[model samples]
Target: VEHKVLAGPFARAFPDAEFYATDRQYSFPLNLPDSFLGLPPWTRPLPESGAASDGSWGGEFDHEVLTVKPGPGSMYQDAAFFHGPSGTLLICDALFAATEEPPPILTEEPEYLRALLFHARDTPQEIVEDTPEARRRGWRRIVLLFNFFFPTSAAVADLGVGPLLNLRPYELGWGGWMPFRWKSREAEEEAFNKYSAGGSPTMLPIIQIILSRGGSGEDTLRWVEKVKRWSFKRIVPAHLDAPLAMGPEEFAETFAFIKKGRNEVRFCDQDVAFLRAAEEGPLSFSVYKSSLGVLRGQPCGP
Candidate 1:
């Protein structure tokens, strides 16, 4: 969410490349910016995927477009979906998978990192796991979601978090499957008051809510149906070490967190700061949790 806001750098970085997005949320000051390749808006009311455009990649790539228009109060208003050859679906910042791979970043001591991972210890058992053969047995063709599960170690490369660095104090809370206690109320309220009222949208809450609570169940169901209809099999996140072998059964487990009751999801600004802090930056995880405890409207220990 920080930095990379400028289209100037991107304009220089890929001068020869043609950029196509649903809409340019970030762009040059000029009314007619030439850096990007333009595409039409998805104003039509069609649920099914359709022929997007002639293969810009010269018949080597066939593109199908799917659109996600999140409900009110959502950070993501409009998202464009792309399906490439071999059933690969491309998306950004919308869905994420929580894989078993170790965090790219660590907390100095491996032991301490282990302690942090203790929180992910209780991941649900019901999400189905199948062998490659089993995954391929019944389905001849399957849709694969790229970056379906975000914040993956590989996806965030060259960004704020990526390439398997040490896990920061805050990133430890990535998977909401773990039960965490907030440190205190005053700390949390102070943060919300400071950041929310006077500033632009921060990455903390956007990442936190999706990882912990899945944002909205209604939206999840809608997307899940789309995935199912498309028969997506693998999840190829931008930051994963490699594409995860997935199917309907796999998507079921990967996205289950989003179905959680909204009442149960909680975000701690203190933790967000910690997670986003510079490497080895100081922040008390205990205190951060306490701060979240306060945000949840729960009593904290004195």
Candidate 2:
């Protein structure tokens, strides 16, 4: 932890300054076994998740670290930084608020527009009109598909962890998920409402998969509670919109599904079919014996 704090660009920028991550981040990085996100005043240490999650605070903001045991494809670790002075909350991939328009940074790259226009078309051979209406249509599709992985009636076109490239080759137009049908604009708009929880921020499908599979969501709920303790007037995620006008309560509401302890958080169930299949298949974990299964580290099975 000290290494991460002292070795990066920040360390280089201010060689005289000291640095530290949040409690769990400093104590349990790369997820020390059984560790989970926790609450903090940054003075007292809490013993949970098989270790002492120490506290640290300084500089101009408060930070909270969240480490989750979600399997592959999930945000294994992230932290939230709240700058009380500015009422701004800094967050990474754990949360997102999809924007109606593509972020200007992305649009600066012309290939991004082509990527959007390509998605706007249902078939590879279909033409993508360059009108504002066509751009809006394409942007919405990109956001939905990126968030849901595979929205109903829409096939995937490489939700790559890297940049979104213009994949059309030799004037053939679109390359991935060719011939797939896209849902009507009206239906896609409705789906956005469901995913965004009626125009507010919501967990990305990839991240929600973690809560849904977290065995009644107890671990994740605990984390959400810790985050809700923060007082942030706005949230700025690593991706998507910046400086979202959201109070802490509005942010917490997105995780209400975890409080229910089930997969009741519906965002077009059909759209998340792939996510469902994952929890039940490749990412599933369970008790192999008695109540001691967890104690014995036998909580996961084939």
Candidate 3:
């Protein structure tokens, strides 16, 4: 049955349990203790002899099901429910759609950079870089997500916080499990070596260049316009893959371009001439696009 139908009965059985009730939805928590949640008493652990294992709980009813929905004030909340073998309640949380503004981008800040690096420490830096291979092949950034039920490593990869950074998306339970095996170690090492030899890349130089030439407010706008033109033509579409996937030569050229832009910024910094440059407002760009299929397209009225 659907979650709505089950909510009332479950709630009646466990009144003190927290009920997350939105205007049009409801959910119950499942917080059963470990003692009551383990295998039934009659069942024994597997034997080395490999004889037919004893039937589970010796014919006792042994199954469970839960229904949940997103909770209020947060993406998810805890839930609890009971089972038959033992009258125990299980606790778990559920996630719902986001209903608030997303966090701002803070990529330029040193702290943010440090956190990003820390999260990526075990990852092969090359795969995530805009390497020559990435540029020639028209590679862009890759996005990966993991679900709660998967292992911690899988979850980290999903959140873009782990070693699986460069790899394409793969399912956890399916054949995708092979990628986590020991055989993949060699590939990871080779990629890491490549990244170490090549150096880190950043877009800060491009930002500096645009800001410098466009010293005034109008110039800043012009810089943004240039960015629009360049990005739409060369960068935006790269979002489909990752930078490292680009071919070697193209990646090298892109790195060189970024390096040159960075050096130009450094050169400008050495002189006091550009210090007084100011604009009426902050430089900003609208990266939002309808074709990207983000939240902007949702029909929900404001």
Top lDDT hit: 2
In candidate 2 the C-alpha lDDT for residue 301 amounts to 11
TM-score of each: 0.38, 0.65, 0.16
Model 2, 1-302: lDDT tens digits are 32243334554565555443333343223433222332212323323321233443344666666666543333345667778788888887777876566677656777877777777776555677777767767777777777766676334334453222434453424344353456466677666666555346767766665545434256656766777777778899987777789887887877776664444544666667665565556545421111111110011111
Could you give candidate 3's per-residue lDDT for residues 164-272 as a string of tens digits?
4444543221212222221233332232222222322222222223222312223323322322221111111111111222222332343242233332321112121
**TM-score, model 2 to reference:** 0.65
lDDT of each: 0.34, 0.57, 0.25
Reference-based lDDT, residue 12, model 1: 51
Our model 3 lands, by Cα RMSD against the true structure, at: 25.6
Please give, for residues 92-162, the per-residue lDDT of candidate 1 as tens digits.
44434332233344335655354434332223121223333222211111111121112111111133333
Clashing pairs in 2: none
Compute the lDDT for candidate 1. Answer: 0.34
Query: Which one wins by TM-score: 1 or 2?
Result: 2
Instruction: Supply candidate 2's per-residue lDDT for 261.
Output: 40
Better of 2 and 3 by TM-score: 2
Output the lDDT of residue 50, model 2: 17
Instruction: Quote the lDDT for 260 in model 1.
Output: 42
Q: Which stretches of candidate 3 lie over 4 Å from their true place?
A: 1-22, 25-106, 109-112, 123-143, 146-302
